[model samples]
Target: MSKVDADTQSKWDEQLDYKKLPDWKDCASILNKRCQYLEARDSKQIRSEQCVKTFNKNSSTKPTIVNPHRPQTSLAANQRSCILCRDLNHSITNCKKFLELSVMDRFWKTKKLGLCLNCLVKGHSVSRCPSSYKCKTCEQAHHSLLHRTQPADTNSGIDTPSDTSGQSTSAATHSAMEKEQVPEAQVILATALLLIKDSSEGFQLGRVLLDSGSQVNFINEKFANSLGLRKHRKNVDIVGIGVTETKIKYQTQSTIRSRYSNFEISLEFLVAPSITGYQPEASLNVSSWNLPSNLELADENFNQPSQIDLLLGAEAFFDLLESGQIKLGEGLPSLQQTALGWIVSGRYKSKYNTTKKASCVANTLEVGLDKYFEKFFEFEEIQGLRSIWSEEQNECEKHFIDTIKMLPSGRLMVQLPFKKHPSCLGGSYDIAFRRFLSLERRLSKNASIKSQYSDFLKEYERLGHMSLVPNPNLDEDHYYLLHQYVLRPDSVSTKLRVVFDASCCTSSQISLNGILMVGPTIQDELLIILLRFRLYRYALTADIVKMYRQFLVNPSDRKLQFILWRENEPTPIQTYQLNTLSSVFG
Candidate 1:
């Protein structure tokens, strides 16, 4: 026994008071709190030590593994497993079974289980007969004597019982119950996802959202374009609690869409803002926003594509939470049918799943090295290719056509940056790709690679390498150079002729040549027109967005210009793209 528990028991014996004596539960509660603090502290220390070891090991081992070291720009911090379903040797896929375990198993393992008479194991009264005897081999007379001492009448039942005849079992059986919510202020109340069936039609993924605080809500852009709602635009600022700075760039646009040629409707949720925001203004009709949920995924198997319209999301639901139509605590008291026409209770505890999904998801999303888990969340395609990445096809062709990253072996890996469904990572390959690329197998599998590389030409970008590090060496005021001066808003000849001088002597740096009326570039042409009405001296405003991010030097080229942030730190290869801009006065 723990020293504290032993002391507590001694005090209880001497005081002859059960209330004064800390029971196993009370002692355990105290220990649990202490253990939590200790575990957190130890985890931090272990992580630190591992970091140091990682450096030392890198010194002796392969340092910037060429392909592996390539910087990857991910929006999230290391992935997090579902707190409730992470370590129960099961995933959310199997979470339903978690509820069948003892209450303690459920609490520590998943939200599925609750503290109850079932887990307490002492739910019935001793006089209930069968429990009075300790063994099946015991004499029936002995068992009967033990149970008979107590009168069968209610008055006696209510009164003090005879000695060693009756005992209180579960406080839960006859008492009220209360369960508190998780301690996070930002919690998801409900979520919905959708699929656009064709250019003109939309279908509901058999779901709608009723809560707020969801990370992201999406709609198919293709669906939006077909609906012809493109002309209507909604630019909403995502402000408020827990919003990231990058979200300022998101602007909402609308489009019209429909489902089945016969079932034409409009869909507009698919436009992703450049930046995602918290209090972000989502595009919605608000009061009139509704979807036809009559069409569910024809295939219960999530592997195949679903014929759906728009996935109801943060736009429609977050607005509802502020109005209090949605409650955060208990699964709703009543089950409501979706517009798609099915009985679905907000009681989202997956009862229909034969296998637990929680464990499957948690184990799959686990960050560290474990091939089985990493691929658990990934899906296989028609020919049984586990990932879209096929070595038989070559680098550019690996991802069918939509260019995603590649493992060393050249395979596609899908991570759902904004998935909030009950079964977040379910089914097979066809669905995993839907988060980023369209799943239509139209036009030979090679259609995606050409556009992927061509998009870079649209901008005068340089850092091409910063997609991997936490910080970068690029400076500000350089991004303005990315746009190739095309044409001015007003028709006029620009006097400024530009010169570009860049070198790899240190890090890639550029110096622009300045002169007016010498060249007819877009910037110069615009300057010439503006000068017509204004004085010779003009206000030259210059700004750089993500300067450091734009100049990412790939790890392989790090020795040339990438400098270390610390003496022993892993040669901090920059991750996200940072940019820089500069301009000269005439």
Candidate 2:
């Protein structure tokens, strides 16, 4: 018989009414009911730390009922058997079965074993329960006492005595009659991802628990086996919590890459049984790396992962923490001032997961020089640009007319004509002309810009830059049509100039400048001056007014410089050809 049963029988012998004490058969029935109730209750309550979770199945060979780490041949001859389940591996107080029993059953179990009444568990008395739950009736923090149920007159303020002993119960007796009602203890498990490495392989991801309270680091045997790590045969004692005895565990050395930083440190870890509870429904042949969860920001339940393959204890945790690779939360209570109210809450920052994605979107239009240049390169293929220009042509023409009206009425306003109608190949050149015209009108509002356009043309005409092409001079080849605009309308200077494009394509898809020449290039005058300074220690510079127009061009080449011009809408467009090498030469 168990020591509890023997103790219960001895207590019955000391009772004043020995004949009224329950018989052995009745006691057995009560014990059976107690076990059944405890089992039912335990099925309802879930323990997060000790809860069963499914893991990678490739590591398992077959489904087994016993502890996977414990050898089948191992004997527990010296271990004390639990009074509730008769298990030799754990004590009665620590038995999961007994701990789930109801308050009444728990009380009887303790009383029968001649144990404390306050804490139904053995080895403690009424003064100490170590429970955090407060009383549901009296608002006190003690187990609820079973008060005698007595029918009383509504007018009377006292409860009639209901005890069969026919005597008044004292406070001490009432306290002993209280049942056990202690809540399960809560534990904080800090889990993170660590990079563990073996001799023959690169660093691999391993789920680790940062336990600063533990004296040493630990790695599960299954995890180490998965990594194919070699273990040293060291018979080291692993002491558990409280007065629990130590067990032998093997030791192994591994290099762990920190989750927060690039630091990799060598650590000695004890290889022990897997700390995770097993799930029976999990398969036995799955092979896959346990990837860390990619959590979104709004996921409220930021609990640790289900499985922890390693335990990084004080030896490694503190060192990592001191090195700024890990950090811990403050244990003190704090309040935060928010728009709603003062919120009392604690925050924990994990070293492994620094940030979470709040939202995602596809950005195809990010602005950059390369992106703009890419669009510019694709300008020929863009059909929408043609339609856009078609819609805005009228507005562009109206703006151009308004700019012409704004200039002095008597201003020559000569129209540049072409020797022949230029090919508007794919009409891109027309689009370019419309853009130039619109931009010119918009820039004409600035006084500095208006002067630049007028001054450049005045200089060209005054220098006899070009002459009217003779009516008899018959030229079959069409001259390229050019457009002009202020180079920098924003700049305020008398010399601020306008640039006329000479690379415009003709109807034949060719530019006059493009076909004119392609050979040795002219030396940069600045570079020439610098070279002379190096040779002769002297340099000279001068401004040659209309030097390009003064340089004579061969008369035959003048045909290629033909242009069309008109003073106003009423004047007919007239043709002219350049007789000077004044314009920007190709």
Show how many residue pairs clash in every candidate, following the order shown. 71, 9
Off by over 4 Å in 2: 1-448, 469-475, 487-494, 522-531, 534-538, 567-573
The prediction achieving the highest TM-score against the true structure is 2
TM-scores for all candidates?
Answer: 0.22, 0.24
Give all candidates' CA lDDT scores.
0.28, 0.46
Give every collision pair in model 2. 415-565, 415-566, 416-564, 417-563, 417-564, 417-565, 418-564, 423-507, 548-582
For model 1 the TM-score comes to 0.22
- Top-lDDT structure, candidate number: 2
lDDT of 1 by residue, 1-586 (tens): 3334564546444544444423456545655766676666766665465346435453555422111111111211112122344543422212333323332333344223321211111222222212222311223322111121111121221111112223542233112111211111211222233233332223223323333443444433333434333333445443434442222222234332222222222334434321122111111111221223354421222212233333344444432222112222343222222332222223322111112111100001123557554444342211111222223223323322352345574433322111122122122212222311331222125454323322332232343422234543344222111111122336343322221122111112222222111211123344345544454445676566433333322233232222111111233311232112222221
lDDT of 2 by residue, 1-586 (tens): 1334564555444543434534456656655765676655554442221224222246454333332111122232115366667787854434555544443455566678755443233544444433334333443533333111111222321121123344564443333323221122222334455689864446687766566667777787768876767787878765554544445457888988854456678888878765443211111111121212332111112132255677777776655543111122343222322211122223322211112222111111245889666655454231211112222334434443443322343322211222333332222244344544565566556776666565666666666776665572433544534545536547544346534456775555666554432222224545444545655446677776655555555454565565554333365545666666545522
